[model samples]
Target: MNARTADKLATGMFWAGALTVIALLLFLIGYILYHGAKVIDWHFLTSPPTNIAAGGGIGPQIFNSFYLLVLSMLITVPIGLLAGIYMAEYAKNGPLVKIIRTCIETLASLPSIVVGLFGLIIFVNMTGWGYSILAGAFALSVINLPFIVRVTEESITGVQKEYKEGSLALGATKWQTIVKVLLPTAFPGLITGFVISAGRIFGEAAALLYTAGMSSPNLNFSRWLPTYPTSPFNPFRPGETLAVHIWKVNSESLIPDVRAVADGSAAVLIIVVLLFNILARWIGRRMQKRMG
Candidate 1:
């Protein structure tokens, strides 16, 4: 074939591939919305689940998801960020750095079900947390830690070396250079990592199941609080996440409109994840503009 013809064909092939991906994504999203829309309402979101009706809302499950998300982020972000900073700034080219990097990569690729099994053994069985919010959060943090570390490390590494050199050349110490210049430049990436981790934690079910048992319609705020001294050590407190609830409704519940409830929960989960991604992208862009 002529070079010109060949080039046109290649370009067309690329466009075709891109369009196919977009079309597939649109189809999946349309299917979910079509099935879920009728069940998405304030009442469905706020009310407790009922065995008699298939249309009962998932208020407790929603709350549990957010609660676990917050707790996991709180535990994972600081430690992961610090590890990243240490690897990028202090341990460059060292054996320790290589080991740390290898560990992070391995953890990132580890199966979610395996992590869940570990949580089941360690947090729920060994430590006696017993399928509570704390146990679930710990499990999620373990899964999220590597993402935060790798993202933070890459973000820090991406900060222009010239900026660090210039800061040091101006009589600034290494710590000052990192804290003032490098960190500010990498803030967008760190935020992006955090958002991604949050989305993952939100959708996670397998790991949570072993650590946080699937229980629904139990939204007692007192059970979640540490201030309640009279609360029992209810580790098997039957905490249900939105994802788990969907699975349960679809697989176990014989309710009449079970399909609608399952689809609606899935849609809500997807929307929440998407919102987090959009917010992260927006924040990253703003940070880039500010840095520029």
Candidate 2:
């Protein structure tokens, strides 16, 4: 075929594929929202799950999900960023670096179920934390770290070399340059990856199942101590995240409106994830503009 004809055909194929993907995503999202949106309301969101009645909410589970998210990100973000910096900026190209990369790649390839089992062994059984939000957060950290590290490292590395050189020429220390210039410039990528990874974490179920347990106590929002079973700060308390709540309601719950509860929770979870993405994108763009 002539060059122009071949190019036209390729463009047409690309459009076809893109359109197909958009259509599929829309259909999936629409189906989920349609079934779940009506069931969600203030009462449903603010109350606890019920046993016999069909009128409970996912209050505790929702809190647990966000609680666990904060805990996991707290562990992942700084550690991941530092590790990434070491790998990309300071680590010499050597066997040790290769080994680190190899291990990271291998960990990234492991399935969530396998990671869950591993978390069960160490975070639950060995650590004696049992099934708790803290354990779940750690499990999630294991699942999320590689992504964060990969993103941070690649983002930092992707920063233009001249930027670093200019900063150095301006009498800035290596650390100063990294902290002030490299990180800010790469903030957009880092934040995007963070939100994407968080979206995955927010929807995670299997790992949390083994680590965080399948039930959350009726938490006392006023209580702020680990000594209290219902305290929000009691990370040791067993808790069910939103994803696990949905899974349990769908599969094993004996509640009258299990399907309804599951649908509502799923919708909430999806919407929360979407909101996180949007928020992150906005922050990333704002940061990018500021940096520029």
lDDT of 2 at 78: 90
- Could you give me the TM-score of model 2 versus the true structure? 0.96
**Model 1: residues with Cα > 4 Å off, grouped in runs:** 221-238
Model 1 is weakest, by summed lDDT over 10 consecutive residues, at 227-236
Estimate candidate 1's RMSD in Å.
Answer: 2.5
Steric clash pairs (candidate 1): 130-235
Winner by TM-score: 2
C-alpha TM-scores of all predictions: 0.92, 0.96
User: What TM value does model 1 have?
Assistant: 0.92
Model 1: lDDT equals: 0.83
Candidate 2 residue spans exceeding 4 A from truth: none
lDDT of 2 by residue, 204-268 (tens): 99888899999888788888877887897798999999999998878876778777888888899
